[model samples]
Target chain A: MSERTAAPAGQADGRTDDQADRRADRRAERRAERQAEEGERRADPRRRNNRAWLLVLPVVVSVAFTAVIPLMTVVNFSVQDIFSPGDRLFVGLEWFRSVSRDPEVRAAFVRTLLFSAQVLLLEIPLGVLLAVSMPRRGVWVSVTLVLVALPLLIPWNVVGTIWQIFARPDIGLGGWAVNNVLGLEFNYTLDATDAWITVLAMDVWHWTPLVALLAYAGLRSIPDPYFQAAQIDGASAWATFRHIQLPRLRGVLTIAILLRFMDSFMIYTEPFVVTGGGPGNATSFLSILLSKIAVGQFDLGPAGAFSLLYFLAVQIVCYVFFTVLTRTGR
Target chain B: MADIRLEGVGHSYDGGRTWALRPMTWTWRDGRAYALLGPSGCGKSTLLNIISGLLSPTVGRIWFGDREVTGVPTAGRDIAQVFQFPVLYEEMSVYDNLAFPLRNRRRPKAEVDRRVREVSRLLGLEEHLRRRSRRLDPGRQQLVSLGRGLVRADVAAVLLDEPLTVVDPAMKWTLRSELKQIHRDTGHTLIYVTHDQTEALTFAEEVVVLNDGAIVQAGEPSELFLSPAHEFVGHFIGSPGMNVLPAELLDGVVRVGDATLGRASVELPSGPVRVGVRPEFVRIGPAGAASGPVARVTGVDRMGAYNLVHAEVNGHPVIARTDAATTFDAGATRVLRFAEGRAFLFRDAVRCGALEPLDGRAGA
Candidate 1:
């Protein structure tokens, strides 16, 4: 593009050098000004406010007791074979190896991951669609906001119970619709595919409103001039959304995607209540299986190892995705 | 380029109860640069929106050349606008940002490429074309916004809404001149809306000044400066503005109160009038020397190039711009003289005429 410039080569070069010098001078002046400000701040007597740190001490100590200490205790338990609180044998690496090698655990891990992936794929676009179609202003805004938020207001276990009864082939409204209206044999208890579909659908129904709400908030924050500019530029509705609305949504969508990923990855309650880890192992997420090991069988050592691994997996994926998604646009 | 003509264009946000812009007939000549200048809430933006078709005027018809486009959409109006803050597709590269409008219209690729490159070169944004528009500084982002408008060869006019508001002061001169240069090179009619008098006066061939949703004056910058049509225009167009002192006009003698200032010989109706004077045209002298009203010097402000001598004439405060070397003690007595043929008399806030001879004797 620069090669097409009409300016004489020598003058352009001179102008470039002049601009570079001016920019460097401005940057240096700004740095000096910042340093001067910092020096003044340091000399200010108000900087010696030591009591503010003390005000935060209670929160820090409570978090340490509740989270950090228990996490450290879990790390300790993961490496030991504990029959009782005092009777324990240090068996490092054994539990970790067995947990990693366990076929049931491996299958559950894959199943949970697949569930999260499908949840995101189904929710993100659907949520954005719902948000786009939602009224932006006037009385309808409050009305629609209340309507879309109704599903999110229900408790997770209640959602599970409602769907559990609702998807039953014998008498429930949804299951009966599929069985008689759609004329399909759709018993979740008898078929693995049916169970998966029911669990996925229930999760979508319960949580999609969350994504829609977040996307709606994001859409509202964009100022009016952007849309007006797009209209003046002869952009179609799709073009306006693709160029103006979607690009500005990056910040909030990043947050929404991260929250949804973390939430879906750790999801257990709704699926557990609805399918109870399924007729087979179809819906046995890692959390449900780990609950069986830890609370049901009371195998503290193996459960500790399983939980640590689970925590590590969630951490790695969330961190990697957060970094990539946040930085990719820039 | 198409000449824009609006006949009785006006807007009312609350149906027809109140108008943001009062209906006014005006014509914008093709290839001529114009400015809609006013204070905030003066309906300049509303006028621009109406012309650009973003708004439909409550009462009136509009035309672009010979075409009646009062009911047309903004895109169909074939005009482009740059907003106060830079609006860009943050995820798109500067090249794509420049190409967006053309691509949206499904223009031929070759024409899009040519026009995009031409606009980038024009804006000095050639080197930044591949960079993400969001990553650039605000000034450059504004340039990309302007480029998106300029990249279309068929654009009839470009409207700017305080485009320099977000630009750094150092870059304002460059961007402003770049806009002027674009106007010169392409000859697209440009209508800029700004509350800034400097931006309007410097960039436009004609400035339409608005006050209280009404057209106060629309003329050349020099005309607005020298021969302001309304008192509001006089107060708004200049830095430190034109001074307006209330006085009585009777029997050809202009008096601030009981003190006589000067006499006007022109056929002027005798009533209350405002004596308007630019600070630059006011001359100060020792008391009892000049043939004018005696004033007490309140203070002197040295403003680098000139000194502002603040004084009071018959309890009315007045500011006189003098040479920087001049100084006066506070509370000193001085006579204020209005330069011959420069001071004007305004009856009911409308210009009556230039102040006539200083001698008390009326001309035959």
Candidate 2:
């Protein structure tokens, strides 16, 4: 048996050696062919320029018309004092100084900062809590999402109108509930405190849903494996939220904070509709003060200067915010 | 550490109408490594989740060292699990990721520090301790996850759900061996779930082979390979698996096609049967041998250490894992022989017993 096996084994070894040599030769030939093809392709310059810029031409043109031209017009207005339709004086920096020293403008600037701070402080945490509690899957998820997003879909002026009627002390359901059920004096048009509270409430109602929806999308993006891992790590619910969900939600929260800050800093329509900058200047934000100068008072020079400063403030705040967030994320 | 006992555990994602896992009872002995091996969607992960208390079985009680823990939440059960995809707190340093569980349990700062350092060293993550976990490569991230599971001294068991799936191919074997070594040093009741047979055979002392939401066989790796209790076990355990051929049992001998090749070692009713033999045991010889069936060679695959000769016997294809020194030309006729005492007969897809090869004159 050993002798017969040895004869066949020896013959097979010799045959395999020959076969392996031929296979190696074939592989080397294939490699050389591929390298030659790659070299030829590298020498072709036209292949490198795929003419991708044509796809972006529309966007460039649209942005120049919508953003750049308007920005230049604002810069042009900020340097001139126009007394009439065709009479204008280029009194550079004088209008800027007058607007900066106006007591009402400074007070409105401070009020705007306070309002944005309060909105971010109240809405971010509340939105995150709502997002965390929302159903992750099932029919209820779609239903809840659609219902939560209803406030954001309402027209801005319509939202102001809805709240104006809703906060009246006489007939509206909310006003009736507050005054009749709880017997509290609640007229947004009467007291400055009431007007401020009503405006804040309306803003939160309209925009907190946007934050919640963004947060919910962020929460949904986290895979189930992380939650499973957290459970197996013996983490408590709070611990899971702190260590897993919150870290994952950081990027979305930064965006939500910046968005809420900018929008609230430039708040005009809702407060103007609800309280007409109200019983006093209590609820008047920066945009309201700017509108008062530009349209109500028709002081275009000072208004343009204020608009530029407001734009600068928003840009600086967003830049600082983005930097702080990205630095801590690392 | 504690032994985990499942008493008639069953789960149905659709509320008792259809089950993801059929009701079954099994015990994992304390301080031993066990593997739950199966193909994808075979309830291995479901079983792992039930054991870890992340899931509650629809109809059974789970016990850990004689205490019923079916009602316990995952945190209350004192078990750790590593997921298939590495799940690290990306915002944290490797040290912080490893220390999270210990810190959550409110362990003392000194003990937490000591264990964190010790586990980091064990996983070779000491140098990357201060680096953010998400910045590390996937293999290192998985190591940090494993280190977190090992950081707690009081953990009863560590469940791994294909923890090396995301790891690079070259690092898989190294990480697997390291995991086995860690199991030895830590003595935790480890339950590893995977679809890879090589991983199961090498990592676990005992392997439970599951199929279609049921365990077909559970035994030592060698026992499973040598004497499979079910046909699925024979088919699923080996590379190229076992060759199952149609055969007949007449009187006391087993006949394939027209040739009587062997006798059954155990009593089998005289009727149709399936003969299963590993590829390694099937030998090929020159055509027109005194005994054995004639097969037509189809192909020969040159695998570095061995050549797989593909042939057809009685119209059924069979593969023989032969040494490179055995050669046969395609389309040539050859005689195939089954090694004595290595063949098995199956009745109704369940293994009946072994088969003993007969001498050439037995049929005559």
Candidate 3:
């Protein structure tokens, strides 16, 4: 402080240094005054506004009523054999052990995970490719956007129903075209492989547009000069996308991947509509099996156990995806 | 390195409706620095983009030395550009940023490394080479972008469009000198576009000033300062600019109100003319007993190096620049004098010639 208050010795006259010293001294005094006021403010809680917490009451109440209460009920059902709410008997952890050991449940878990993986793998690159190819301006931009977003606007069950009929070899044009045009024998209802492929294709078709639109929005936010710079740098079409467009799309793509992952992992409607857990349970994902156990067979306790396990898996995977994707995006 | 020649180049956004740049022929000689200076929307950036092959001219041809590149793409043109904003890949380290151009051209890994290191050293970015390009300050990011251009040895020229707008003031001086030094060291042709006269004057050997989508004047710094070819050049090139007052020309004698300013030996214009003088050459002295136009001092602006004494003569505004030691009082009256040969006469805003003040001191 003294060194700052006074100019270095022998460098200049003290008359100017006197002015410097006075200015520094005033600055120090102001700093002290600010510190004193801050100290008082810290010491006196009554002087501060503490009502900011009240603004969060609605959120707390909503979350408690929606997420917390339902979650606690699921937890309670997982540990009890309940014929009626008041006539319930505690069968601690028995449902968990049986459900965890069940071969069908284990297979469905793997199937769901594999489906999510396939969905991401097929959708992300295809979406990015579509985004990169889309028009940036002119009247065609609106047309292209509308066209790309068409698949996303369809109802989930409708998408499943459409694909189910569409894959029928006899009456559906798509299946007939595949069979007659390519000369490939294809039947989704009779073949396990065909059923799985049908469900996967259905998911990919319905979800890829979301990724593409997100990536397109990301690409749009980047300024034009980056592309101009890349062009002048002698970058080819692929190189430009690799260095400029792809990196710029990192944020939106992260969101896209997370949304796709969560949606695909928890997916039940589209596959259920199309495959109905399919021939010999080939398309029976975790959600479908859980519903079958809970609603069809009325095994409330085991279904509750399955629900918690599914939630836990989603939580762990989402956390990992959020961390890894955000870190790499940075 | 090669001369960039633009012949009859012009552009219009709406199909021959309104012009952004009128067709003109120009050549920037090899291994020299030139600045395209103008106000906003004066076609400076448009001209730069045309030269860089980012925007092809709607008419006429472009040549890089003997090679006619009128139809070439931006990537095909051997020119590099620094935009108004720094353009760098955020995910890449400074090393990769600098090596991007070379890598895009499929240069060998060793060669890319060598060029990256060399350019990074030139930009003083050696220490931050391993850091991501986004981590640097704006000035340093601009330097990295500049390094990307410099990394390619075969580049014909380097173009800059208001590259220093985002730099901090203190860093501006350093970056300007660094750019000048790099030009000198590399002997690469540089074309800089800016609205700032100081940046243009300091960085370029020649400056082309534009106004309203047309070239106003083009000349060396001293020529621009001493003998502006256009009234706009005089106004745009200097601090405080030049003061202009409406006048009439009678057989080459320039007269403003009742004062005979000077005479030009060139062909006389009987129509209206204007008297142009830099405030530095306009002198304010005590009135009375002098056969000169009197002015009423309105205000004095105290600049650090000088005082600007604004006054009115025959209801025409005139400003006189005096040293810091000199001052004038408001409402005081004085005789206005022009330094001999420093004042000019302009007809239709085009400079006619220097004026020979009728004052006898201009004789001997």
TM-score of 3: 0.90
Worst 10 residues of 1 chain B by lDDT: B355-364
Query: Which is the leading candidate under lDDT?
Result: 2
* lDDT tens per residue, model 2, B1-364: 7788999999999999988899999999999999989999989999999998888999999999989999999989999899999999998999999999998889999999999999998999999999999999999999999998999988889999999999998999999999999999999999999999999999999999999899999999999898788889989999989999889998769888877778888777799999998998888877776566778999999998999999998999899999998888999998788877778999988889788866554531
Proportion of native contacts present in model 3: 0.88
Candidate 3 lDDT tens digits, A81-101: 888767888999998899899
| lDDT of candidates 1 onward, in order | 0.88, 0.90, 0.88
Query: What tens-digit string does per-residue lDDT give for candidate 3 at B128-227?
Result: 9999999999999999988988889888899998999999999999999999999999889998999999999999999989887788888898889888
Question: Could you estimate the TM-score for every candidate?
Answer: 0.86, 0.90, 0.90
Choose 2 or 3, whichever is better by TM-score. Answer: 3
| Model 2 superposed RMSD (Cα) | 11.8
Best by DockQ: 3
**Model 2: clashing residue pairs?**
none
- The CA lDDT at B172 in model 3 is 95
TM-score (C-alpha, index-matched) for candidate 1:
0.86
Clashing pairs for predicted structure model 1, backbone only: none
Q: How well does chain B match by TM-score in each candidate?
A: 0.95, 0.95, 0.96
DockQ of each: 0.63, 0.56, 0.64
